[model samples]
Target: MPFTGQLEDGRPFIATLALQAHGTGVVGDGKQLKFWIDPWLSTEPLKYKFPSLFCLEQDKRCNVADRIPDCNGSHAVCWNWKHYPATEMEIEELIQCHRLLSNVSLSKQVDRWVWRQEDGDGYSVKDARNWIKGEVLSVNNSVYQWCKWIPNKCNIFMWRASLNRIPTKDALLHRNIYVENGLCGLCGEVEESVDHLFSGCRFASGMWDAIASWCNIPRFYVFSLSDVLLVLNDLPYTAKKKDIMYGIIIIACWRIWKARNDKIFNGSVSSVTLLVADVKSLAFLWFKCRHKEGCIDWRNWCNFVLPVM
Candidate 1:
């Protein structure tokens, strides 16, 4: 019924009759005698909506913009559109689509992922596509696409370091020597647990002494890295500074590992001076490589690192 019709006219039905009939509209304004008939478009439920394809998308259908010219100004684009019904989630998807079309594009730093339990693999695909196209969050992975905005109460560098179930290198070291002996290597007065090896050992004490001035850390010993960070988190320093300190702790632990290996395998001895020198040099390199672009620079840590803690 629509073909050879008055298609170009925005009101397609009116033009169709004109084209199919006598090449003139039913109601002629110029002629004194004329006839008019209200077209029977109401026979279908879709009459009100499909004035054009663009209008269909505007009404929350899935048509794209490029197809507007293809429809050729047709009114049947809605095609039996009886106010299509959608589930709540479908409604949400429509809202998201509308946002993507109507607003100015978003910034890259902002991203979001839907935390819906019902979402399947399709959710991840959609999440990635939306993110690559513009600013959107990937909540599927539970990672912060925008971590820089969050206010950190403490430097979580230690926390960020993944904890594994592997046996401690120190325990492995001692176990290689004595399978059941829990004797200490420092004062020989306590068991060689993590606390005893790193904190109470004569060798470990010597290592701490060298970095004590540069680290300005307190003279207390904790059993684990978690304990160290737990105490450090409460320091009255800025979050940025705390992150730097956390970096220092990680580097120090790494050096401690090296020193332990040196003592155990190479039969080489370590000194506090040597360890301190290693910590400062490595800390400087770390800050230069990681934070060179920031307003805070390496020299600022001098007083803080040099403090006798």
Candidate 2:
């Protein structure tokens, strides 16, 4: 895989293949950047942005320089398609592709890749590790907010649930795992999904109702797990109270997921009363141990009363 010369496919190549790695962005000279495969035009590779156009391309590995030989020339661009776009969709995609590449002009400098996670300092082991951690712990542009009050396992579970990454029955089935049934283990009704198990199932709804009454918050109706997490934001409470409520909500969801697993794997039936009690108990224990002062009264906690600090 020589990088300096032309590839066997006749695409002009660059001297570095570092762009293939994560957290690297290209400073395009066009000679080395694959027009369809590299993220030279945008943050995403062109092949993904215009799948139809990519399929029609005859030279899949053509360089940006090969496609747009002389950017300043009158006829600056050329198309090499297996067959020219015929359908309306294909034509639309081709139009979009051309529009995107229209502004791109080649530079005399050689193409090079640079680390995007660091600013002026370039790449380092620490920045790479941090970038990898952030990428792994994020989903759909939502980063995991660590809750020190709860156990690390609960925080991790909440992060996974937020992404619908939990191995619910439906998720398991999607992964081609053998699931005898996809029905909710707790409610035995709807398909077991991260959202349904934590927010939509009848048992889950009952548990949330109990939790709401215990915490003195208005009953919340949520269609998704992420919605459940945001319910505390609209509440009229002090920041400290809201923070505590956030932990309670997280712990409740964690308990709900645990109950669902218990039912499926241990033949344990879920009771809303028992589940709510467990959420309260477990949350109290975690918060008490992890709180800075560890001076919160159990009665006030049970009553959802936190003195303004």
Go through the candidates in order and give each one's C-alpha lDDT: 0.41, 0.74
Candidate 1, residues 129-185, lDDT tens digits: the string is: 444333212212333111231123112322342232223443555348443444553
* Candidate that would win on lDDT: 2
Against the true structure, candidate 2 reaches a TM-score of 0.54
The window of 10 residues in a row where model 1 has the poorest summed lDDT is 28-37
What C-alpha lDDT does candidate 2 achieve relative to the native structure?
A: 0.74
TM-score of each: 0.39, 0.54
- Model 1, position 53, has a per-residue lDDT of 22
* Number of the top-ranking candidate, with TM-score as the measure: 2
Candidate 2, position 283, lDDT: 82
